[model samples]
Target: MRVVVVGGGIAGVSAAWAFAAEPDGRPRGGVSVTLVEAEATLAHHTTGRSAAQLIENYGAQALRPLTTTSLPFFHEPPEGLTDAPLLTERALLTVGTVEQDEAIERTLAEGRLANPTITEIDGDEARRRAPLLAPTDGHRYVLEPESADIDVAGLHQAFVRGFRAAGGTIATVTRLDAARANGSGWRVETTTGPIDADIVVNAAGAWGDVVATAAGVEPVGLTPLRRTAFMVRSPWDHESAGWPLVADAEHTWYLKPDGAQFLCSPADETPSAPMDAKPEELDVAIAIERINSHTTLDIRTVASSWAGLRTFSPDRSMVLGPDPDHPGFVWCVGQGGTGIQTAPGAARCCASMALGEPLDERIDPGGLTVDRFR
Candidate 1:
């Protein structure tokens, strides 16, 4: 079977690799895979811009299972796929003021349900974990000790390497223009040329709806929301690398230590079009203000800034599996902010469903199949 995967982000590469090989890393003999990217290189958009972190209690409830299922892969990747571990120890600390006590309680309950390691902490404990936090009364916190930093580039390359090793082809600077049903297969027209495919997986990220429309398939209302992140020099001379990622309980802003600098974001989700996103100066300034007010880190100047689009379905759960009206048109989009952490399991499920196979027993999508959108 000939399978064509559109997009070259983490989602696309992971899906292509999964389609070309088994979980044990053995190449599937009967299947041929092709990955098409419009950009000059892979992961040139959202995947490249991610503040790569794996938080077990993060993202939509339906996606939490996928994140859990992907943990084994991060802990022990397939042999020869990567020389180093994909995950490094890091923790997430969510905090709020007395006004947000309800939000903090709700988050703690949901987080502990997903991972028992998630626990509530007192104001003093939260301050100790993140010294930069301003000492204030009625502060609440929740810590997810199992969270870690993801080696995004390494993970993406692992999938690329595995796919190439399995005889899968990748076409860079090749954009999918349109696709039409041709008998039992499809004639995929691209910017470079045309190719035949038995199945087409839409992992186009923010452009998911556009890809579907081009293929004459019903678009699944994917909304792309822009999130801005910026880096600032850490003022503290003492060791700060051990500090956990501190975030607002309401997700108003967040700060993570990175070497001599700190990565910060306002956690703003502005609606955006499918394009290369850029950080607005206003957004960066607002983030700095929020971070400064919450912590001792008086961030004044930004070293750098960037933005990425987090695409979501109407329900915010991922849109996976084949479309109800188009069996050959599979979906792997609507990752939102969970794409990196959930890539392994999500791709596995996408490949399985696209090939007409049953989902892996370990993976439960929480009924996030594309059929729900219909």
Candidate 2:
């Protein structure tokens, strides 16, 4: 079967790779996959603009398996695919004030359900892990030492390489203007030209609903939330790169070590649509204030700033599997900030549904099924 995967983010690329993989000598043949990206380059949107984190316990319960399933790929990756390791040691620290103790405990409890490696760390220990954190920022903290920093670019490139090596085609600068159900497949018109496929995978981050509408499928309530991130030169002269990622208990702001600098985010999720995103000055200033107040690292000036959309479903969980009303029109959007970490498993799931194969044993397709959203 021929599959046309929409959106060239990590999910789209991974799906194409999975679909193009050689089948296990079964009667069914491997699929021919074509990946479409609106931009001139793939991953030029949210995938390229991520903070590059891999927190296993992050996101909703249904999505955690995607992260867990993706860990192996991040650690060892497919051979001959990437020159550099995709993941490096990094911790995640969630701090809270005394008044916010209940919230912290609740979060830790939820995290333990998916991440057994997480543990409660006292204030002093938290400070030791992230010396930049101020002593007064919070009274308690939870630490997930197993969390790692993912090489977003490397992962994205690996998928692209794997897909192409498996004979998958990628069409960049191809914006889908319309799509229609034709016989047993779809006829899609893009900037480049027309294409027909047995399945149309909707991995279009912020433009997911737009694609659905064009395909004559009922649009799901996929809301794109804008998340702003900026880089600032680390205040310390020493190698201040190994510090763990720190975030407020309320999920208000976060800062993490990025090379010799730090990447800070206000953790804001403003509703938006697919477009060339830009950082808001007010948002950046707000993040600066939050980080400066909570850390000893005097972050006065931003080295660079950018924003990306984190699309979400109404329930905030990913919408995977086939659309309930249109099985051929697969739904793979609503990843929000978990896209990079969940790409591997998400792609596998998408491929499973696309090829009519059993879902990967590593992933629990129950909660991630598109029927839930309906």
Q: Going through the candidates in order, what is the number of backbone clashes in each?
A: 0, 0
Off by over 4 Å in 2: 22-30
lDDT of 2 by residue, 184-228 (tens): 889989999999988899889999999999999888788899999
Model 1 lDDT per residue over 1-374, tens place: 99999999999999999999998788999999999999999999999998889988888887778888888888888877889889988899998888998989888899888888899988888888889998898888899998999999999999999899999999999999999989888999999999999999999999999999999999989999999999889887437877899999999999898887899999999999999999999999999899989999987789999999999999898998888788889999999999999999999988887777887675665567877767
| lDDT (C-alpha, whole model) for all candidates | 0.91, 0.85
RMSD of 1: 1.1
What's each prediction's TM-score?
0.98, 0.95
